[model samples]
Target: MREATHDPATPLATGLSPAELRLLLSFAYTGAVAGPWPAVLEAAETSLRYQAWGLLTLCLDVFTRGLTPETGLDVLAFAVAYGLAQVGRVAEDYILATFPSVVATPAFLDLPAHLLIRLLRSDGLNVLHELEALEAASRWLMANGNGQEDLAKEVLSSVRFALMSGRELKKVPSVAAGVADPKVLRELMVESLAPMAQLPCRVRSLQEVLVVCGGDKLTANLAARKPSRHLWFAHRYLSAVGLVKRVEWRALGHFPDGPRFRHAVAVVGNILYVLGGKCYYGVRDTLASVYRYQPMDDSWERLASMTCGRSYFAAVALGDFIYALGGSSGEIYCTDTVECYDLTPAFPCPRRCQPLPMALCGHAACALDGTLYVSGGCDEACQCQASLLRYSPGEPAKLLAPMNGQRAGHIMEEAGGQLYVAGGLCQRDGQTGYRDQLAFEVYSPKLDIWVLLSPLPHAHVAGGAAVLGGELLVLGGYSHETYKDTHLIHAYQPGTRRWITRGTLPHAYTDFQACVLTVPPALQWVPPVVSGNPPPPGYMP
Candidate 1:
């Protein structure tokens, strides 16, 4: 034991050995010394062990500047022990970003069970798949013994089993065998397979949004020639900051054989029901065939055909029924026909409902509180009209207040007891050349009135629109000036009452359809850990 002058001002005069005292004094006075860093670090480590945390932190602040992957783990362990969350986060990120392979090292396996749990529970850990994280957690639990079973259960709970595919879940038993209780593990599996409405865990774990297909560049290029079979899903993810969202357009399964456009799409539970549309540019190419898509498995199955072939129609889901309204049938330019399909049965067929007061096509429709509302479309003469129709059960269609403008190919979505209509072709001043309209309007069912709101930033035609998370999202469509297709995604903020461009689609699409449904979160990749540097000053384990 060596000691120097006892001044309360200098806290370093405590129990340091001669070598540590000399090294520390030299570093404090001159900020430079000629000794092995390892020796100096050992003294700092001793200070940490003795609970001289202030002195240890001072030493680490000066020396931790040159930390490498090897030393990062030590510092991380120390920071974690001392509850220095920010410091631990930096060290963890550095290790994962630089020396990811360290996660597989024996040292990682030896991390205290509690520390392992903390790491696993961190949302920042971006593992390639939840299964990989599960495996690591399982390994740590097994090494620690069943005594940590409670902790192991808590650790495993953070794993997003619902996000895993059926194939991936099959491997859970093999990997989770000794780590989690059989009953607990079985509960997780059951939750994953449970219906979306009845899901007990992470009830809103997956954030689902509207997916638009076929309005892209591929569809435009093939429009004049032949239809394209390719289709894509526009997936949206909210970033950590919450201010900006990212959209990734992934390749969903394609349409069967012949591709179609101007189709009507509606979502009933998890299934997407697609109605009639034109398969080709030819007048005779109008299709009556219907199909349904299951996003979970990316499978499409043909459904019973509609009563009549049509294109540019509107479809809406009201409870267990889907209502398909007016559109053009090949020979007939426009029709007032309305049909409803009951999806409660295994194999369903469409039945004709009371026709509209007047024949119309290229219209927009939505169902709210058991009433069907249709607005702004081309009439029997194929001319744009400002007509609005309301149909209730056991009653004939009733004409409501007309829209401000004559709109065709517009989109309608209902939210918070109001109907929002945006983007379409409008005929003003009796002009033959139809103009693309940017005007946005909302209708209140209770008041039977239409109110003008902020117009779209970009005037689009035949775009797919839906209400998601209380915000209005308008997907890919085309503009008149360019006469070109656009993949632009525009979202309207209710708070601001303004439309902001969220992001562009992978490809521009027009006349495509979109619907929102809840699905699993996509998988991501996480980095690894490593070793080499000594533990930070005062680090316990």
Candidate 2:
């Protein structure tokens, strides 16, 4: 196979062939037309290797004043059929600019339903909610395109997209009731909006804090742009502890023009940072951009570029430092490259921290006392890691603790002056007899020993762990198989030394960072208002 040339004659390198060129017509120019009625866009409707629908819609304005009512309707018709977006404001401006009485016609109704349906599947509600005319068009399809499978698909897609809106839709209440069933919403949002497949995977760095205060708070920018994804993971941890008033939906692509940050996440005071994960550079290649989310401003700021461009790496923050631990650049491989940024105000520079002793990706980390602890990561050999290393802020990390057996993809919690490692592959040697490899163990920092705790009522690894009400609450993660498994959340009580299963997470919110946030006792109460609700909100207050 040959690569597509650096030639305008060919836009794609492979996949679609030359014979497909029949889908399009020669480009026509009608911008100068001052005749009776709407003019047609000149860009070809179709071309080999792709659809030129976007460029054509752009021409709708460049050529027609969009004042040409019939021409505007035609472009909208094509856009609705192929699910084209981002052209509405310009196109509408043209429609009013042309200053004609625009009306919907039979051709508009006859357009393929797939585009309208696909539009519904757009991310957040930005595209979908913006499509007032298109949504109305889809409703027409549902009522008129009823018996046809194509029409039914548009109806279903719109319904699915509307439910995904995460905001209440007055028009679709009954449909929302059926689809918004806590059981269903979480399943729809796990995958990203990017038309890509599992670009390897990595969880964000989240600290488990105990907040006795009540109400649910969104984790700053964890899913800042896509609250739907945040809501799916938010419920289990946020509502469990009562730290937010609600999972607000202000997080829809707030950084629409910001640099791309894929497969990455970071947590600072009230800010969430997302770095290079996977952004489409070519059809298959991923982007390497970084973004920062500020919770207070509800905005994302672009940050320093990564020294080494990579995605799918685990990130952890200890003290004023944030670290991108390990992950791959592209291939299904593992890396131990570490890049960290010191947020110290006087003079901050990002440099490589000590690399992991082994290449551990898809791992979890927790900070305790003064040391950064990491555990339960899988390696290149596809082996679970039982090795635990503690990184001192200024000094080198020492391998003070080794788990009882091979463990990976499990949760780690540091509480009450002890390190609790549970729900990983705690392999047993012949010394302990059991056909199964599922169990948990706790490391005593004081006694310098590993003690076996109660086994999970059901086996789980790579789950989420947070210390809430003095118990370790473990949420959604994969079992031995299936990354999409969501069933029960196991709560382990350290005092009673037992495991009690709680409600299942909405879905498998596996392997992502889960934090238990709390306002410190000192920061808990705000000073009352000196002059009717003029309260000072802060630790100083």
Candidate 3:
């Protein structure tokens, strides 16, 4: 095999068109392909044909990032054909995330039987009910007609028909007619609902783990706040005798170096990047250090520090770069400076982006649809802000509708295309001091409006917030009124529009980072069920 040439017109031994040859050669040389998705797909196929693993990887990344409801099936099929398991997994996740919309797309009708089977078999399918999954499969079968009887039988085994209730199961016959024999479907339903023999438990996919990282911890004796270096993640959930619910947590070793708080963390692919923050209580203790952790290897590597040390700032990963926005820095304290670090470049350093219209600290931020949204932080004057600002590189930050009220030290996370803000400090009743903000609010980007949601049952100030299992989780943070840290985790499900206690952390922790990482299967653990009962009401953790 020979390396591709720089010449645009050069013909390769491969039967790709001139345009595709150029696209492949460009990716081989400059590591970038410029064209529509169809052209890129052609080049990707060419890379696979020629055993060009590197080019194929780049193509896979493009496919992964470009995935939408419309393009997910195509990407999944391509990834499966190329034996790119990781890309296929990501495509599967995207498809599951937008399953309802994906099923409505024209591509859904054209999905091959095997690919449809692969999707239906996933435990992570984000369907509201098993019946919806049945409906999707039935639609596919009806479109392809009776020739897919084998596919229908496969769908029967692939779908979790047992998860449906008696009333839900009644609808199975109508859906099963084209996909599988009606009588056989009934038998599966019966066996699944109640089996004489013990069967393997069905749990949601553990492809990603929810990790709680460095935070401030309060000792048992009501002692001083100490920054912790501990790292732990939820290993498994237990269903014990007497309906006891417990979540087992496992340690994944400490983050390299000492503990810090007010730091910003973000996940790019499977890697976790821990950014600048304060190492200790002193204002001078702010750090410019940066490091990244690879969950698969349980290892960490220090990266080039930011241009300036920052604390109480927001860091979000957007596209190929990480943006460190308004936070308290050395000398100036609260500064409006913003920096962007390119993850693709070796030895990357921070590049300045358009600064916020005003300085912010104790603020929270998250990325959605490649745009960065920041809200609820204090200015240098120490006045809380309710302004919602939208930012992008090379563009002036635009302020949208403000929050219901001023807040700081809050947690802002994006779930289902909307931004959710909860647990913050805010002034009320003309009081000089700040109190916990319990009123939760959500922002709609499309309408440019903010509306209130049910307030957190408990105040969550300065806690770690992340979306896991399709719910917004508020991890350990101290309430402003009590001045005590909590280890309990609270989850807000969008469907129910209510908050429920998920579980507790290994210990009382606050001011820490929370983000999900894709850990290798070797590091995952599922403990045996224990004997106990549910935590009593008003029980913390």
Model 2 compared with the native: what TM-score? 0.45
Query: Which 10-residue window in model 3 sums to the lowest lDDT?
Result: 525-534
Q: What is the C-alpha lDDT of each candidate?
A: 0.70, 0.48, 0.79
Q: RMSD in angstroms, candidate 1? A: 21.7
* Poorest lDDT segment (10 consecutive residues) of candidate 2: 243-252
Instruction: Find the 10 residues in a row with the least total lDDT in model 1.
Output: 522-531
Cα lDDT of model 3 by residue, 102-178, tens digit: 88788899998878887888866755457778899888888874765566667767777545546667777876665
Q: Which ranges in model 3 have alpha carbons more than 4 Å from their true place? A: 1-204, 240-245, 527-541
What is residue 485's positional error in candidate 3, in angstroms?
1.7
Q: What TM-score does model 1 achieve against the real structure?
A: 0.58
Can you rank all candidates by TM-score, best first? Answer: 3, 1, 2
lDDT of 2 by residue, 294-334 (tens): 54344656677676666546666777887777776667467
Winning model by lDDT: 3
